[model samples]
Target: MSAAQRLHQYLRDARRRRSVDLALTLLPWLAPVALLIARWQGATPAWIALLVGLCLIGAIAWRHGSRLDTPWLIRRLNALRTDMDDSADLLFAREEGLRGLQRLQQAWLRQRIETAPTTELRPAWSRRRALVSLLLAALALAAVALWPAAPTSAALDRLSPSPQIAAAPGQPRLVQQALRIDSPAYTALPPRNEPSLEGRVAEGARLRWTLRFQPQPDAVALVFHDGQRLALSRAGEDWSAQRVMTKSLLYRIEATAAPQAQTRRLYRIDVTPDRAPQLRVLEPDRGLSLMTPGQKAWPLAFEASDDYGLAGNARLRITLAQGSGENITFREQFVSVRGSGGARLKRYQHRLDLAALGFAVGDDLIVQLAVDDNRAPKPQSALSPSLILRWPADLGSEATGIEGMVKTTLPAYFRSQRQIIIDAEALIAQRRKLDGEHFLKRSDEIGVDQRLLRLRYGQFLGEEAEGEPKLPTSDSEQTPDDAHPAEAGASAKTEAHDDHDDHGHAPDAKPAVFGEEGSVLEQYGHTHDHAEAATLLDPQTRKLLKSALDEMWQSELHLRQGHPQQALPYAYKALAFIKQVQQASRIYLARVGPELPPIDETRRLSGEREGLARRGDELRAATASDPTLTALWRELEPGAGGTASASIDYAALERWLREHDERVPDPLAFAAALAALRDQPECASCRAQLRGLLWPLLNRPAASVRPRDGGDASDRRYFDALQQARP
Candidate 1:
């Protein structure tokens, strides 16, 4: 091979290039040797220069390439290889030609040996260079040995976690965190002008946040607590401890030195169950619901449990509630329980009676179940099961529903219009009496009932709209059993047990049964809206119902105004609605009708209308106008406590008034009896009743009864009478 080709091949040697490449081959050993020599001399400048040189070389090498082909290393290693007997046959001419035939070798190697044209034979000079090189090598070695070794590096700098502290009784976890208190705490929100906490973990807990103001809380106590983390340290107000690991965690936070004008401060802490025990009230995702009275009911159940064994003596207790007398709408045990599940999961159940629990469906019973886990360190949980313990409303409370105004005069906006004239007149009158404000205030409380009466009566006055579409006749609207007269079963209205289902499922669904010959099923077998057809006395059937109600409301006004006598006819008018409204209203009327409710004119007998008893308002008005009505009024609402004589006077008044002989001129006699009301004796309550008749008879304007100097004695008496009479 050509000499150039050989050199090229030697430089390009792949794996061996690191040990054989040109520049890399020569520089590494030389650089290290130079560095060692300077370092031995303790030469700061030389060392710095070498460092700079190495850095520059490294930068250049990094930017371009890295080849650790140390030339001296390869030369020494190659020399050894050549010396080895097994490898000596590869070369002969190059070394020997250079050693012997000066001219041919020089001619052949001149390009390689560019620096020197000749070799002068000088053994002494060779020995001197060797000695000098040895001295330099020795000095480099000594310098390297004396130089200081590089300083050792260190591990990362960070805070270490600490063991959890013991918790206080009734505490979830007393997590104490060290807060960085470089500055005072202040609120960022309004009331915003307050002190701030420089290093509080959680800004504040929802329920129990106590950031003190004057003498700030303990710098490192009750650090801070949110739902999850209890930060006990700070990174500019972050106080959570390093990440905590546990199956469950509890957090507790509060202020330290809290009471005596403490300054605003914050804290945070975290607790792991493994290191510390924490207690918490196991709460329900939903709340408890119970059945209302007279409603269809189902089973009721309650339960409670805990994490640590026997969060001791966890028992459920029920309260009847102060006002809820005997309204337990259940049929079975108040609290029956079942046990199963790995944990002692006990359920207290009660089969409810749908008729008595007067509670509302959405209302919950505050059934509390308390637990105490008597540990050497006692632990307790305020956990309770907030179960919705009731049947659906359709099955629970049988609800009762009753078939369920302002005006001011104003001047007309336009002068030319007649309606405008009336409004203006009203406006003038209103302004003279009271401003709209006061007038509206009066409207809020006063005489509006009269309008209500008018509307109500007008509604009743309307006939069950003539020719309106009537509901189809069906079993649901009638009693087929009523026609049979000999059915051998309970009325379908009364619920029963142990019944088979025709739909082939269960009788519990309140399934409709086949109609008997004359049963309710037969009568109302098909009417879905039975209330319309079956309720014959309802507004649909009786338009008079509304009128009757109006009369009653009028009667109340009359009675309140002390015109008990005038109130009588209205009472009787009201009494008309008894059968007209419903059986219940009718029953109530029947009960109260035996004696008038200390009202006006109830004692008055209806005069004949040619041949029939006068009916409704005309009759009521007639009775109210008569002396006999005045007499009966006296008896019911006796004046001067004259009930003794008032009763006789009323009876007489009734008889005479019924005589209706305009020719007898005996109306004066009834008048005389009324005039003599002061002579007879009666209790004060009844006497007041008699006096009650005057005002409504007079139709005086109504007024608000303010508390009197006598400390509401009269009002109390009247209200007391009403209470006793009604319930």
Candidate 2:
């Protein structure tokens, strides 16, 4: 320590040693009898003054008074104390004398010091270092004591103190004042947020949403339907929701009708799962597209995502079908994102090579996408919307419809194709399950390729359920579900006298084993494996009818290729022979109807077989009770003439009319009559109506076209008169 500093400290301690403050007094050993020192600064002066005063005599004789020595002084103080104690015992007989001596000694020391020049001694800071120290101390004291004095006007009450004492020692008075204070209570929480939807979805009959989860176990997702109180358990961490069929794969989720606005399936999973497997595409909607010549292979992409705080393990099967019927598939390719992986719609691009698919102009491109997650929780499965791309460069002017797709309904096409695939699959499964008792029948759901279904009505069926005809019998007997596939063909044969004919696989039928040279059984198998009967057909008869079919197909193809006149004889021959095949098949004819035809007529042809089998049905109904028509039928003489049918055809009269009339009337109206003479002419009233009015009408005139635009175009009568004048 600095010398002056040490002196200052000593002086301060010496002063503290004499202070009467209770807190100060509690520290007894701190009292200085000017005997010695502890942690003192500037205390020598006080010690010097006290010594001089107590000297009582000049440093007597060269100050050889060793009494000034600290140790010597201590000894004298002790001796004086002993004498005083003895005197008090002998005279006053009070111990108070010695006790009072110590107290008085300290008091007297304080008084002397004050009289000299007392200094404030802080318990912390040493006092009286110099003028600077004193000023600092004063300023500190002022700031504390006078700090914005909380206005004492409305003052604190003074306590009367202990009755035994004049004042309370340690406390300061109180007062009332308002001070600015902080509020540590009310608080507002922020609103919740989520990621937004990023893109568009294709229009299709069904939309499906698959939830993907992470594997290593994080949390679990709890999904609720629109307003179901409890969520239905789905596959794994995965769940599926289907729309009628869903409109688009992409649907933005807004506020859900849940207690909290935050709605999501919560799943507990980790970033990675050790044994996660690729999601099974077999879960649903898995099949290859039916490729047409020059058709493209499908190109696909998928979105697989996971909950926050976990990794989304997506396995996308991206495939491309180019023009040459070649297919490129990217399967089980892993796509991963960590922690609340995002679900923003991102276009994962793929291009199918035109040459690869063997596709030419006017050919369709079929693209497919299969997606799934390979995480621990139930993996998610998704089939992206199939895209039909038009290779405009190749299609040229021929590009139209779904291929060129100028105004094609893509969603419809996809739905239809998928449905056909689904149905075909269902038939195979059903056939694999059941035996020969079931087969195909005509129904509303048949597709456009009627002839493609078969030469007659179907693939085939092993069993026939045509029970013996009864003489109008009893009360109530519903027709049994026809067991024979040819029930359809049988009706057509009898009708075509016009055509019927058509199910699916018979599980016990052993697939009608065949070599691939030219699969008659396979073709039949497909027919049975379609919706023609919805699952009831035999395979053998389907094979036998194949040759006849080739002929018919070639004829139809030529006809379609603007060679209808060349196809005329073939169409007629096929019709008659196909009918014979159907009739001989033992009602075995059956078929899986096409998915849907491009035209209504195509649908009906495939479904009912030939031109309206229902026509003869209408004819029968027309003559059943009408006397005039019935009489005509009876008198006309039927081909296989008999009273059983109670009908006939006036073959001679029809011939005479055809020879005499230079021109026949609307030929279709006289169809039955002409066929009866040239084919099967009958004399029912409707037939007479045709011969009587239609043929003569045809000789009258040709229908006329209307005037162009607005000029000379307003006269309906003029057009009609012109039409009448054509003949």
Candidate 3:
């Protein structure tokens, strides 16, 4: 390439880079702005803004930005490119009349340029500046893309002015409205202004409106769609009205002046109702918890929110399972939780004690949070998802051999108690060989062990230790079951066998099923073979063992009373209850959690909001105003009565039908054919065929054509003469 061509090409590339930089900067700003517009639901504004931005970018990119003239190129080449040795000046001189010094210099410059490489003539690129601009632009674009989004519709409308009002044109006659809505103090809402005619406002808001009509009408009234009208009291040229906005509605302005040019324009109002409280669990991160042996407490945390605010207090709904396996009963209690945070958001937390809930080693507790909001008509509530806190069977421990299998597979918790019963039996058996004082002391120790074991069993039925008749208390309030702790089948400890033998009954005759569907005996009933019993003990054998444990308990009690004879029978009974509870079966109780009110998702943000009344107004305006045309149109509509009238102007009707509908034939052409047939009655067959074609046309109703208001005098005279000549 020549030096001038090289210089121009480099400058053109530089111009393109400038355009690219401009577009990059614009893109970062434009994309986010377009997103915001879309979020606001402004489709027209988004499209218009997008089109304008694209045009501006295009002009800069392909036209204005790329305008690199030869003169400007030469100037840039001389200033930036080092290889051009004053060749620009020599090149410029070639275009002008070269006098003495210029001609000599031009010749020298040409010879020097010829010796240099074409690469030397090319303008140097500012790579560092371009790279920096691209990086900064990319960062800005990413930042905009990653920004947190705002809420939709209502929130967007609140921040930005209505595009319709902003884009409305200045007209000779137009209705404008300015609304101020004062929310009730109880709602804790502030007053708001809307320049546009329509938007949502708080229910029970006091709405004040100022209506201005250009070319000023004399009187105006707000006509509601529900057949109610509120007359605006005039003050000078403006009209005003005030009313408490209790419900949403569509309304229009009906204006009247001295000359009576009736004018109408419509608007809409929406009322936003207060929303219910929402509650969700925020901590522990899981719904179900299988607690370890040593876990003392559970961490409880929740989040609650309401559109208005929260009042009173939040509560933890606690459901405790009060037995082992299938016979478990669920008991629920509401415990108040300390809530922190104002109106919008609140946090609730409590450290729940496992022991206080009367949970045994095999029992479970189900819990959830409940929240209430201050809304009325009726206050609303929300319940969090249920969470389980269980003292599960020791499935986590590793053990070996048949003993290990028994420890892992059986109800392992009560195995120690059975050992205590055996020890007591052995001690009672050797009582005759020891001294009286020593025997009494050891028997007393065994009695104490027996009471402790009974209390441990009692806790599974939500009971306290022996001698402590009341249930335990924790941070939360507890409501005990109606049945006393002593009555829970473990009551055999309180009454001796002597009383049972004489009365034929113990206190509280009802048997404790121990979380089984029936008696532990019933679960293992029947089956006599040792091999069968080894596989699994039958219910009858289990019943016999339970009877033996009851006897062992009485025997231990008698020994403690310094009478070994009475203790032997009870010691046998103590052996029975232990053997039954240890059988290996899958022990499962249906976990019951907090009972929550069913959520009505359909009621969310439910309120009255209508589309803009202007769209309906446009549709009404486009409807035909002339009654004749309207009636004709309706008659021609699908499913309309198809009756035809003889008086109808078939020619005019056909013309109207042909103009409005492509399906109808030309009435004027049919008229000319029939008229020609009338004159040529000599051809009878042709005339008959024309009459058959025109018979349906003759039956249609004649068009009631209104005379033209203004017409040419000659045309009017000719039409008058034709009317006069008609018979």
- Top of the candidates by TM-score: 3
lDDT of 1 by residue, 1-727 (tens): 5433543334344324332223243234344455664544446756676667666655554443234233432443245432222322222235554445554444444343233232221111234444565567566656666786432211111122322434344323222222221111221111111122221221231111222222233342332212233434433423333331222122334444332111122222222131112223233334655444555654544444433233323455544332223564422213323422323233334444433644444333444444443332334445454344443333233333451111133211111222222332343356557865655433322222332333333333331111111124343334453331211111222222222221111122344456644345533343322464435454453556655656756654653453334545665555555455555445433344365467447445754346455446331223344555454454454232333454455445435544653533333333333433433354464345445533344333345445556348888898788889994
**All candidates: TM-score:** 0.16, 0.15, 0.31
Cα TM-score of candidate 2? 0.15
**Alpha-carbon runs more than 4 Å astray in model 3:** 1-177, 212-220, 226-228, 231-240, 243-248, 256-263, 324-330, 376-378, 393-727
Ranking by TM-score: 3, 1, 2
Ranking by lDDT: 3, 1, 2
Model 1 stretches astray by more than 4 angstroms: 1-298, 302-305, 311-313, 322-339, 344-366, 371-377, 383-727
Candidate 1: Cα lDDT at 726: 91
Error of 1 at 503 (Å): 68
User: lDDT (CA) for every model shown?
Assistant: 0.38, 0.35, 0.59
lDDT of each residue in 630-683, candidate 2, tens digit only: 344434433333342234444443444445434433322243333333322333
Candidate 3 residue-wise lDDT, 564-623, digit = tens: 556645655565565655552333346899999998687668853454354344322333
Q: Output the number of the lDDT-best candidate.
A: 3
Candidate 3 overall lDDT versus native = 0.59
